[model samples]
Target chain A: MVTLEDARRIIAAAEKKAAEIGQPMNIAVVDGGGNLVAHVRMDGAWIGSIDISIKKAWTSRAFDITTQDLATHSQSGGQFFGIHASNEGKVMVFAGGIPLKKDGKVVGGIGVSGGSGEQDSTVAQAGEAAF
Target chain B: MVTLEDARRIIAAAEKKAAEIGQPMNIAVVDGGGNLVAHVRMDGAWIGSIDISIKKAWTSRAFDITTQDLATHSQSGGQFFGIHASNEGKVMVFAGGIPLKKDGKVVGGIGVSGGSGEQDSTVAQAGEAAF
Candidate 1:
């Protein structure tokens, strides 16, 4: 049972990390089951960020791995190449998503959109570290 | 480089299949990159069907697997549980989506919304068979 407070903290950490890297982003956090828990659309973020955030969160929850890891597989054309269509609005399979774990169990996930894929992923990684 | 013709044919086949089962549905077909190619909204379909259709199409394009495969894992609480947030309007992870393949290669996906999950999946599977 992950709390909303936990989701907020992760978002704050992710925002801070984006600022540090001079990137503005939209972020979304979801529980382990892929349900939306919290979301933030930053000023100057891209319109696509809203969808991207949700997708990133979905990807993290579905794969139980960082969005970056899925992106790696997506680029390599491996077993994950065509997996994105399976989840619909729930999977990004691209950069900028990370799963949040507590005590070795994935409790939630964080997603960042608006920046470049690399920058979004960096921000997401920062959020994961905060948890 | 898939065209609208391809999408329309798939939709017709899927709709025909739904009729065979006495299910009314909203169906969507999307290109390989998750872009909209064609869409059909049936009479008496649920309002949510539109979004669900898009999401299902998204899921197929993003995952490169039939929505049925994704639904199977979603039911089991596997790594795919939370990936739906990443693609926003594109991924469904439910039973109503199917990918379109040609010459054993994936080119697009079809999604049906409106019926029960099982019914929707059955119609989608029929569409796949048409192609």
Candidate 2:
């Protein structure tokens, strides 16, 4: 179980990376249960991405994989082709969400938005590295 | 505007109140735009109430009124009879939701669940008192 302190650390790391990249972001952190633990929307962050960020974190933790990887697997001919429609549109198969694992088990997830896919992925990676 | 710090403090206060009341809870905080700012589910908190808690906060901010008040207005023959049917059922008319006001403006909201309505409202008030 990821402690609240751990969630805070992950969010701080992600926020630092977002700042370094000059992109305001909405970041979400969710525990192993796919429940939100913490979230931060930086100044000037897009309001529309708030739910997306939360859902991205949820999707990452729910599937125990990075959303970027999920994006690839969810392609038209892939195993999870229609997975996006499964969770009432909460499944975000994109580049900004990453799972946080401890001892080979997913402990939590971090999701980032308000930037390009690459930028979002980079910031999410920075957050995942905290755990 | 409720800063990230304010959201954190609200959740923390709510958590403290829940602990004192011996109830594990799911708490949610939302900003002025009815966007989620932070959330926390204490260990042993019911997962079923996660979305409910969030929606409660959203409903509070969306209408600038407590869910308890909304419940009254939504009662049979009340001015808002059937108001619960609006917003795709995201409007939670209950006691756990309260708006956070600052400088005479609704700045955000806090929602709590996992206990009786009275307990939930008490914990939510502890959070709202933060601002």
Candidate 3:
């Protein structure tokens, strides 16, 4: 049962991290069932950040692994190519996404876009720390 | 030249961030042309997260604004009304997307899904950082 307050805290933490790094970002948080909880888009953040952020969360929840790992595979010409198109409108074969878990159970996910991939990942790492 | 390697690196960094945060998400990366450069879909992300993520990336590329901002407007009944469908399979009204830029020029976009709008955004933010 991920509540709005929890999502808010996560967003707040993510925002703080972005500010610390001097990077503009857009962040998002979701629940166990893959539902939205909270979101924040910093001023000057790129517009596409919104999609990348959500996909990160979705990828995390779906694979139960960090989106980065999947990204690696995709680039290596592993299963990502075919897999990306497998789910139709439900799967994105890029990067910048992660999943949220509690007690070894996926409860939700998070994603971010803006800045370089490294910078984007940093902010997401900060949000996860908040939890 | 944003090669496939660049996209791969961005994806890797974003995934690392996701793992550190312990969140599950679906992530996507695009080139300056809004064409998919790299992507990764986690094992179990929700079906809808994929669309949300891509939309985020598209939103960023198209409007030069974060998907979160567009989401706010869409929800608030702002100016973009009907603008979502205006693109004909190019624009998404939902959350989770961002654009990629190089040297102040829009190069491409990214998107994520499978989490709350907030979570999705967070993952995208991470990708942006990598740039």
The candidate that wins on TM-score is 2
Of models 1 and 2, which has the larger lDDT? Answer: 2
- Candidate 3 residue-wise lDDT at A94: 44
TM-score of each: 0.52, 0.90, 0.52
True contacts kept of 1: 0.32
Best by lDDT: 2
Ranking by DockQ: 2, 1, 3
**Superposition error at A62 for model 3 (Å):** 1.4
**What lDDT does the true structure give each of the candidates?**
0.74, 0.88, 0.67
Model 1 Cα displacement at B128 (Å)?
1.9
Q: How well is candidate 1 docked (DockQ)?
A: 0.14
**Per-residue lDDT value at B96 in model 2:** 96
Off by over 4 Å in 3: B1-131
lDDT by residue for model 2 (B1-131), tens: 87777888898899999999999998988889888777777777887888888989999999999998889988889999888888998899888999999888997889888889999999999999877
Better of 2 and 3 by lDDT: 2
- Scanning candidate 2 chain A in windows of ten residues, the lowest lDDT window is A35-44
Per-residue lDDT over A5-78 for candidate 2, one digit per residue giving the tens place of the 0 to 100 score: 78778989999999999998999888888888767788778888888888899999999989999999899999
Model 1 residue B10 lDDT?
A: 77
